[model samples]
Target: MELELRHLKTIRTIAEAGSLTKAATALGLAQPALSAQLRRIERALGGALFERGRYGVRATALGELVLERARIVLPAVSELQREAARFARTRRDGLRLRLGGTHGPLLGALVDRLADAVPDTTVTTCTSWSERELAELLAEGRLDFALAGVCGSAAPPDAPQLVWEQIAVDPVFVMLPDGHPLARGREVDLTALADEEWACVPGDGCFGDCFTVACARAGFTPRRMYETDTASCVHLVQVGRAVGLCRATFPPTPGLTTRPLAGTPLVWRHLLGWHPAGQRAETAATVLAQARTAHAGAAARSDSYARWLARRAEPQTAVRRRAGLAS
Candidate 1:
């Protein structure tokens, strides 16, 4: 009822540690001072939170309750503070976009489309990231949308928080040793090595999406139960460590093979990250729609891309085309 951020932090620390002295140390406060604050909070709430026991301080039912609420409230409060800061700066007139891709190809395509479609809108890419970093940033309103491969249905749901838009899909392949079974078959289908053990890109990397999206397009999901994201141990097609269901663009490691799936549509699943806060102005929406159109057009035939631009230009033209009279 009457607690501040520090008070809630202290309460959470105490509940998590289960001892006043330990919690104080954890919270970087003197034990006596921490104890006094806890006592004051208990007085405000008219209930006891911790109990003095043989082992140490332990949570009473109320302490546990307070801690639980603090966990949920504190994070939201912190995010709100950051979001609020943005409002004070220029009122966000233009769109600030954040785009992410699993690898270089998609990244290139994304830029090309935005340059063609929304040339007037400002576009920005993150400094350095893996897949998970992109996901976190998008979820936290740091990105307008992330242009990455759809590995699985692990993305956040759209509604109060986020909106997911599917842009396109592509096929999958297999990377294996040159002479490996199925590798020599000219195609890397899932059934070719259904029971194969594998090395993987961490859930935070491009290869991670490659595995999942490729598996999904094959009508099956990959079983990547092992992880290794290291410098010298790049995720290339190696002789002993593997045969994975993915495309050739993956880290191109040595001693491995890359082959296409025979008849499977193992593909590149693309998505647009939509944040309500990031889409505040008419300019943002127009830019977003433009970027979406350009990417779609670029991925297809050039004639189609140009026609798509004409179609986009029609919206503005039609209004002008009809402004004088019903022509």
Candidate 2:
């Protein structure tokens, strides 16, 4: 009978996703359920909102107008919620800083930074469902900061009114058993391992989706034998069960090694986001700096990764040296 914030969020999700199925996936709702909800919203609004098509869905004229209004209303409401959260209660030892991300190395670095900056305050990390969810937690004051790995330079998911900055661009690497044939090489070709069974995290989220897309581009679909987290994936690789995708920042694991994909230039860009309305901007800056420092430290600590960087730089250095000699 009446529209609510949930309805507004659904409208925005549909507009951005461009299809009922996709919007349902993003919102974690079944397709039929999302469609039913959309129908009700449309009925209440007195017109059709989206024009369904074979390829996808597009917003009708009425839908466009509603979305424009939703954008403005949602942020204001979120700001109000954020401000209200600040006044809930004053905690001793100042404010608690909640930091989180899936990157183990980055998380460790951030924890160290927080300890140094706010030794007496509470600091914690968590695994948020996704970047957008992490941003929501920040806006609601449930989370003070978040570190998420996003691929490419595409605009981040719509977490209205939060500040996001790219902290590090980590090169993607392939994890394999140390005794595997490809493990001896400095780098391995994706096509060379087309038939190899892969172990990757489940869900259409960042890690799995990126691995799938990359494999498909290489003219094969990775046979994911095990759907698990980084720890489990590493364990599987150690036993020679399957290979896994990895980032350079991950600490070295015994019986397992990582190599670059020879021709595929895959990467995960680390993003740090904070709630500006929560008045944690200064602290957020410190977190970002600490994360960058952590990334560098992680790379430095990994002998194989450090050597890879050095080998990559040698060609450039040699070219410069030759030029100097010529001059």
Candidate 3:
């Protein structure tokens, strides 16, 4: 009953065509249907909107007033719709990247690489301690990519909507104060720290349980486990209140040292995840390559990891040499 935008559009069409029959054709409606609709529209406005004649149709005084307003309102509404469409397109194709991650150094490294590779891109980041939170954000289209880690051979978060790719795998390491007795060693046995308290940043995965299993395998139950943020964990280790468990790629701290577990009891895998159906999926491969490069750069910067790699390669190199000598 009330005047609506469609009624205004119909009025504008009739005025522009100068006849109901012609307007009906332009609007793809039959003449009778168009005439009926116009009657309803005019009745809703409480007056006749046109004066019909033998030659053609002309506007009455009321029709002229309605047509004048329709001219303004219809064009403005059309322009508004066009501008809205343009704004949507601009946002969709503007090379913006929304990245989410759990706490880690690799996210920052990945951001740095993206900045260098695509100078015009607008990059944003969201950080959380829980990998599930990041995965959910990606599924909800709030984030373009998610960077997180999982324990050795453990499944990534339970987001079937996302595709997870492994960027790198790292051996889990232990952090000790510079003055700790085990800090002098190249590697420390998990059992060697049986009586010491432990501190680790909390995550929404089974990693904590995995650590506990590793300790049990080493023949001792850790005395007291502290779940805290990364900074607090670092402080606990630095002040010798508790040993910290960290990835081998953890950056060096002034008062702390990181060493690999003697037998590599634990491992961490860096993952990059994205919704397979999202617009960002088109660039997923390129972004994944950049992430791998960033991870490699991080590993290269970790002295302990570099030494571990060298030592691991030594055994393989000696085996190759022995086989060649025998041959």
**Backbone atom clashes (below 3 Å) for every candidate:** 8, 0, 0
For residues 93-163, write the lDDT of model 3, one tens digit per residue: 55888889887699999999999988888989999999999997876667888999999898998875589
lDDT of 2 by residue, 144-191 (tens): 778876765556556767788888776778888889999899889998
Model 3, C-alpha of 166: deviation from truth (Å): 0.5
- Residue 208 accuracy (lDDT) in model 1: 59
Candidate 1 Cα deviation (angstroms), residue 256: 10
Clashing pairs in 2: none
Scanning candidate 3 in windows of ten residues, the lowest lDDT window is 82-91
Decreasing lDDT order of the candidates: 3, 2, 1
User: How does each model score on TM-score?
Assistant: 0.61, 0.71, 0.71
Better of 1 and 2 by TM-score: 2
